[model samples]
Target: MTIPLVTVTGKSVDDKVTVERTGFEEILPKLDGNPDTSSDDSVNPLERGTELRVTVQSEVYQAWGSVFEQRIGTDVDYDPSTERVSFTLDGPPTRGPPITRAAFSPRGTGTHIGKFAGTTCYRPTGGSSCTAADVYLKSANDGFANCFTIEGDLVVERLPDSGSLYGSPGCGGAVIEGQSFFGERLSRSSAYEIKGDVTFEGYTNIRDRVELLEAGGGVHFKDDVRIDGKVKKMRGVTVDGSLYFDQGSSSNELKIGDGTVIKGDLVAHGRIKVSDTVEVHGEIYTTNRKITESGGGDGLVDETGNSKPSSEIHKSHPLSQVRGEMRRDLTHMITSDRPGRVDMSAKEPATGDPAPDLTGATLDCDADGTAETCRLGAGTYKLDHLILGHGDELELDTSGGSIKIYVEGGVEVPKNAHIQVLGNNPNQVEVYVEGQGAGSDTFHMYSGSGAGGKVTTPQDKASKFWVYMDPSDEVRLKQDTSFTGVIYGPGNAPDGDGVDIYLDKQSTVKGAVVGNFEKFTNLATVKYDATLQNKYALAAGGAARGQVAYLRTSARVVSVDS
Candidate 1:
């Protein structure tokens, strides 16, 4: 293979030397009819508009226009005879006068980023290095050979004793101030600096970050606030409405007035201390310090999926945490208890089985309902109906096993013995007893000191009733009272409503006669037959001292709900 010798026409170089583009130069690759290895005068790459292989050696480089090739004449002295190339430059360099604080046309192309002659007046003293000047950057197309430009003499004079550098009375128009000025947007009379405040009538957007040394008055943002500063202090930084610090922001101190309303979430890595109350419409979660509120409703939800009353939940944790804690507490209460309530309102198909008569029968619940035994085992015991003997106690002792007592129709425990129904979940226990057959009665849960015997009265629609008691053997009913399965017959019981305790004709009612009663006037000395039917009230032999009572009439007696 033949060697590829690269060379430039006007410039000769050693065999190891290479031609390349320098800083900010754009170069195009060589194409057909381009410079050859033995060419004399090199054509300008820009004028020829031919692709050229230029070694890139700088951070930026460029070369692309056909105009550069025309500038190189065919007989022009080219340095490297091994290469032929051409190029041309369109025009001479154009420069502009140094711009002062006075107004000037920023329309035409001009050198901007150059040393301008102006008194370097205000040299910040308190360790603040900031030069107050109308900075005009060089045009994009202009070659930035010099960074500073001065039409007059270069002077470094001490700034006159001035209190403030910007927005002062005499310093008006000297400060290039406006709400984001641009090329065609320069104001003619609005010199660089002005006397009055630099009013950013609308939103003032500085594409670059803004740094404030020390602002006396508060910096207000009708829209948003984005400041990068080492330390910022103000009486109050008020956002027109909501305030949001981006995720990356790490503010030292952020405080809101007493009644400030935040409609969004607040996330901060540093410490956030609220002086007074803080009302957030969204969730509030903090990983660092404490979050507090002065006073408000606990509109929180508990994990039970229950909407806790605003008056109950404490204002310590977030709503989610509060809810979780509540659910945990409830679960402990239900599972931890020795006998928790199992609402069996959904179990048991209704069967027309008669109530089990216990008048002359005895059962050892511990013997699997077959024989009498003291140790009751774990299993479900079904009694279609229960009829307590005139005077008997039902003893059920299940120490090692979990037993379930279920009565189909209802349960009636003689006032004599104490009854108990129990079960367990994974070793824990549950109890339920319902009374039935009669009107309505409650399950008497027997307590040690007459406090545990509970009588659960089933609703009129439900067939059975319940009585969860805790006694073992002996007990007795009150003299004139009888414990019925569904309804406890405290005959002529004075505790019932007046309308439910009325007396029959044989026994007069001295107090109010409350139950609904109908009078009859259609009996004309009726005669009796072989198949005769008659009804009569037993006579009270002359001594008619009435009793005070109420009877349940058309209205069925209703048990008071706890």
Candidate 2:
């Protein structure tokens, strides 16, 4: 059906020229002092004139009047063939501001794992997380190499600190590490340093390599477990899972425990000792290549394959490190290069520019989302003690760019305080403290009471908020409350009995932390956001350990990164 167009008319022809507009079509105006004919096709509305004017269906459509006023660009040349639709906004659009603070990757290539640098302890109780830097958790207080008291199941992975929970394609299947700095001669294991002997209270799921340089105390599986990794320099290994031995080395004795299963071939140096059922999927390759086995339960139940030892045992294997130097072997195996541990130093947080008074002006920093809101857009703000005590909701408008807040004195956030950031990256919002010492100079964020203070964003984009304050006070990152940024409260012990950075059992920190981490009243998880390593130049303003090197090569290795 050919629908006829209805043109709304006005008496004042000069002020309002009528244009015919069908259902969602562009307006075809009568440019000249004549009405457009009914059969007239769409034509350019511009008449030869210096100024431009647009005619609508009626003078009552005043919206186009304001649209033309805010139109950007030089010329109004008409393109008759093309029709374009646009989404218009009355207010200004949001854009990240030109960053003022210096921006640089703290770790030049992010090869260091100093993300969780704790003087006392860097304890990960239950959950696991990725780290961009090498974690130096050797507690100075405790004698051992950071006593890892694993009760349930404590995990530590060497994944990228990509400010995300899932894996990334940047590293693929390869473990993220600086091999040049941590070569086999340099590093034994990848990103962990646990003292004492080896014991898998849970299931043993390992690949690559898990070195046990010293078995003076002997290895033990306190519970039912599975073993898969390549263990070295142990006196004897009793397998609960499968076993693969390099029979090509020396006459290595084999001690198979109860219910032992072998995925590959089992090659023992001396006579095989079995207490229970021994099952080998492949043939046994030993020194003499002859079948010689003894013991209780069931000897070589999978004797289905040829029971004799195969003769592939003397093809010149790298038996140097395996059997030792003919004299000092298992007893002389140094646990780990403990004496050669890389001397570590933490990145102290920026104390920010000092404040003259103990407490300054309180902000109208309350957001009710209706009449009033705290608009903390992009830009650097130097205030004295920002206390978010009033109103349940406080919103920081980060629509412009990164918001760097340098607070003097301290900051107190009470319970149920909902601080919403309008930005994405947690690095985009920073609050650096300029505390004096103890007392009012502490950073106090009271959360985890009922429903704690949640400093989240519209998307709650992983880890998205940060605060660098006095280490002597309480920055509670607890239950029902979620903050998504790095917390650097390094140096200075917590005063009398106060905790440095207290996190409750149900609390989980998205980013990393640097302080005297001791008190965790409950199970807590701190997944180090690797993206924060050099996410932005450690630009906390003042009193910060500005971009310290893990191990500087030359004195003139100054990275002129912006």
Candidate 3:
């Protein structure tokens, strides 16, 4: 329930300490009640040796999303000059978590620290979790707990006799919206125009303003979903619709290891096994016969059966449809027998010249190159097997224009091999890897780049370097390296297996990604650049099926904490 907002690393002197975090908005200055004292626009610092207990709580930063948790430490100070916060503490240890960073405010003075009776116990579920807020009325305790977080989706097993989550979720009459209660659905009272299935480049306060619009329900969400870089609650908002991330873009996530986050609806093909740690952001739409509970039951509890609910858990769908028997709506296949999900037949190697092998040659396309540097200029180059292995330096000069390379065989960029894009425009280079067989068509983006050949583009311009893989083999973003580009792959034929991209635990991707299959051993944080989508869809003269996206909503006004 507590996040070491930012750990307090160490203490310098007894009265002064150091923190490992930054970005303090002037520790909430003590709420002085004096009137008309505008002359001194300065905080009245705590008197010397005044052992102050500082609760460095998170303040609002719409840009950073939301600070959903809290951490505590003692003794705080803010320097206006450096604009940083310092701390004084009861030196180390006897502790839970290290003190986090914060602006100066008397500990426990904020409304967030209010003492209210709570049950952490949930009911029929279905309630929106708000920020550290003291709601307008009695308390906030629907399946969505009070100020505290509930970890995953809250589903109503049995709506209280009131037939609503504590009478429209205790936020008083305000529209529970913004990055805090994003994708959440409530019963009545004031409602935010929250649009489900948001294909967002960014989210606005007005949730309905996005490209997609639909109310969500009747789906089962599983696992912890973390939006990389978007400051959010531990338990993310349940999508009334679906966590259809980016129909166009994929996710670079902190879904951790085996930590899959399914936001909105879930319709599995067979019996759904609910794990102990598995969290649902929405209701599970399956017959009691179709679902089973494993592990200690915190995820799904049945009040009626005292074990698993006999009735199906749904958001809005009718029970008769899901409870009696598993119908077609509840059982379906994701990979239906279909041919060619993507349109890749349009762009083929222009029939012009026989493929040239750039195995050991340092062929410079324009200027005279040294023995080690191979320069490629702005032109359509067709190659059979391109292996710029160890000691090969290939320079793609896009200053003249865009460079398109069509390969008929496998391409390998091994250790010590480097490919540099000598251009600023993001959409300047294209490399399509397509060969006769699967192994021959493999695009080895990473082949023992033992800590080398880290290719990057100016974040927003990540689309500048495009790699097309017809039947993608594998693209691994090695550890300690950052990548910025679109990894396009597969699906031009009915028998194709779609796209395949592998990501390393420590690797970070900055652009878009579309693959039929993705593997993550650890957390892969992707800071997506939305601009790449347009250029991707237009690649190969607008015949490209689509690109990927890591939807990042820019900072906008979600609400004003009163």
Scanning candidate 2 in windows of ten residues, the lowest lDDT window is 98-107
TM-score of 2: 0.42
Error of 2 at 441 (Å): 12
TM-score of each candidate structure, all chains considered together? 0.20, 0.42, 0.36
Instruction: Note the Cα lDDT for every prediction shown.
Output: 0.24, 0.37, 0.36
Model 2 lDDT tens row, 312-341: 222233345323311111112111211110
**Against the hidden true structure, what lDDT does model 3 obtain?**
0.36
Regions of candidate 1 where Cα sits further than 4 Å from its true position = 1-218, 227-234, 241-252, 256-267, 275-287, 292-562
Ordered list by lDDT, greatest first: 2, 3, 1
Query: Which of 2 and 3 is ahead in lDDT?
Result: 2
Query: Residue by residue across 198-265, what tens digits does model 1's lDDT show?
Result: 22222222211122211233233333222111112222233342333222233343433333333333
Instruction: List, residue by residue over 326-407, the lDDT tens digit for candidate 3.
Output: 2221011112323233333544545422223243222432122222666766666766556665556677776666677776
- Candidate 2: stretches off by over 4 Å: 1-256, 265-275, 282-295, 299-361, 364-373, 383-387, 408-412, 424-427, 434-449, 462-464, 469-475, 489-502, 512-562
- Once fitted onto the true fold, the runs of candidate 3 whose alpha carbons sit more than 4 angstroms away are 1-346, 350-371, 437-441, 447-449, 458-460, 477-482, 492-496, 538-562
Residue 217, candidate 3: C-alpha displacement in angstroms:
25
